[model samples]
Target: MSSISMRKTTLAAAGLAVAGTLVLTGCKDGNEEVPAAPAAPSSAASAPADGYATPPAGGASSAAPGASAGGYDGASGAPAAGGGAVATSGQSFKIGQAATIPFTSGSKSGQLALTVTSIEAGNPADLASLNVADKVKGQTPFYIHYTAKNTGTTDLSFASVGHIKGLLDGGAESGVLLIAGKFDKCPNESLPSGFTTGKTQASCAVALAPTGAKVTGAEYWGDPYNNLNKPAQKGLTWK
Candidate 1:
């Protein structure tokens, strides 16, 4: 299979298990700390083929469009009506707010108005459809429902807008759970063909909170925001 196809297959079949502890730094809120624990091990069992990969720790492989310009609500840190203004790096927002942010996938670059609509608790029993191992299945699952729109001039078809991660209470990052095939509970998909200006798509990301913990927020660390050396800000957060 081609690299793109392989990546899609990998995303669909199973979740990516990080091999070690991850220490986050430079969080403006001073709450972006992850507890020291061994990373979840990858499951040996295979899933039925057919899904997209989780957004990589480095970045995502696809891009989406953005929302129109407007005003910023200082109190809630969200964009006002008409989609508001393009968000700067490191900005914070509330649930249901929209952030018009920039992103790049390969040679494609564009603006995407991403709205993290809600973070809902999911029943662990629903995970039976996935190929997750029992070792990690005990972790609580949270579904991050979001919408992405192309607000730029580029055609970002097949590009994914999936850099959002789940945050536990006290701001620890949650483990990502990948699904191999179609997940009816929280379906995730890539931008379809002809995803030009004004095009929009809705998707979901699965975040697994450690047993006994609760998910309270999410963070977006796409593109220049993830760059450590540059002066650009680090990431955007939402609660």
Candidate 2:
């Protein structure tokens, strides 16, 4: 299998973004860009598919301590609870729970109240609408839907805010498929105009598990948490 580098951008000075690219194997050639979909609110559109595969090579470490195996059964389609306490790194939260953590985008820095509202299972057939590789099409699909609220000062307009991944049973991370364009099933977008304090945004990431396994949880692998070289470093997880 050939190795390919997937650029994962982070904030940089002068409107430039920079971050180390992750080397992944077994990826098909050509970029997969879906046409932008109509804007919509973030919510679980459907139940996810099953199956398990090892995370991309050199991915983040295993789930942090206290991570568990389960699914969130919270009220469907409801916004996350409000005015909750901020959560620290390495802490675990459940579905529908909020975690206010440090956030950075472009040259701006602040805190965002992030909530993993649901992990909806998606049909592999959905891949037909995308230009993904065949292997990716055969794998199960999952939508990691979330909501983010800017809890700190600073307008994060046009700054990106998403570093979430699917967590399978036994602490293994799922293969995160990044589509360049909009995917209606799991649409993602950056902080809109004037995303200053008290502003909130909704987005989603696509997670693919090998046929027959399911995504049991989700994790926030922002900043130091995504340092693949530091295998000991852990990220916040939710089950």
lDDT of each: 0.61, 0.61
Model 1 earns a TM-score of 0.65
Q: Compared to the true structure, candidate 2 yields what TM-score?
A: 0.66
Per-residue CA lDDT of candidate 2, range 1-239, in tens? 22322222222332342222212222211112233334344332221222223433323333343332221223111233334444433567778877766666558777788889999999988877554455575688899999998877777787766567788877677877655455779877667779878888888877888888999888886754444565544556778
Q: Give lDDT tens digits, candidate 1, residues 7-121.
A: 9988765543321212222121111211112324323222222222222242211122232122122312244233566665556678788777766765788778888899999
Q: Cα RMSDs of all predictions?
A: 12.9, 11.2
lDDT at position 210, candidate 1: 71
TM-score of each: 0.65, 0.66
After superposition, which runs of candidate 1 have C-alpha atoms over 4 Å from their true positions? Answer: 1-84
Best by TM-score: 2
